[model samples]
Target: MSSGNSRGRGTGRNQGTGRKQEPQKRESILEYQKYENKMIRVKFHGGREVQGVLKGHDNLMNLVLDDTVELMRDPSDLNVITEKKRNLGLVVCRGTQIIVISPVEGMKEIPNPFQQ
Candidate 1:
């Protein structure tokens, strides 16, 4: 009865693997300074949309928006927007889960371009 297995004491995991965990070198879209104090709309995944004044943004794409208004979607159709809306004043948006970010200025509903 050996007290402990001689070859099982040390758990060798990723020991000889030359894979060095490196941080992501992805560059930020940046240029958020110009959008500060300007109205912008951010559409997130899962069909969530919000509009607010750009207050501040960091290198990580995290946004500090003021006077944020979350646009409510139709229950029947997720792509449709209802007249109802909710105000989420002063919100911090995550860099991830952001699908689209556009300026509210000069923005209008356009017909589907895929239509023949």
Candidate 2:
């Protein structure tokens, strides 16, 4: 079967162009080097928080954490973390789901400012 148009008919991405396009470089915003091998807490978009030792991360923001454990929220109150839910050991926190990344040592619990 011979088609009339053969120039622009291929399964390749650069079908019409003669040369292939170069992929843009992706750079990571967080300095993983500073937090490497240190305890860090990552908060997800849905208020889920996880604590672990920072291992590595990619440009897309996906982080590899060692000894990862998800913080369990109080059964009565979703705003409070009662304890650790499970020991994940090793886990990858997706960049898209992560809302905050902070050092574990820097975190402190304070009384609610709005409670009257």
Give me the overall lDDT of model 2.
0.88
Candidate 1 residues 2-43, lDDT tens each? 776657635355445756556768766667777889999999
Q: What CA root-mean-square deviation does each model show from the true structure? A: 6.8, 5.0
Give Cα-based local distance difference scores for all models. Answer: 0.87, 0.88
Against the true structure, whose lDDT is highest? 2
lDDT of 2 by residue, 1-116 (tens): 88566575464677667887689787776788899999999999878999999999888889999999999998788889985577899998999999999998878978999997
Worst ten in a row by lDDT for model 2: 3-12
Model 1's TM-score against the true structure:
0.72
Model 2 residue 42 distance off true place after TM-score fit, in angstroms? 0.7
TM-score of each: 0.72, 0.72
In candidate 2, the residue pairs with backbone N, CA or C atoms under 3 Å apart (3 or more residues apart, or in different chains) clash, namely none
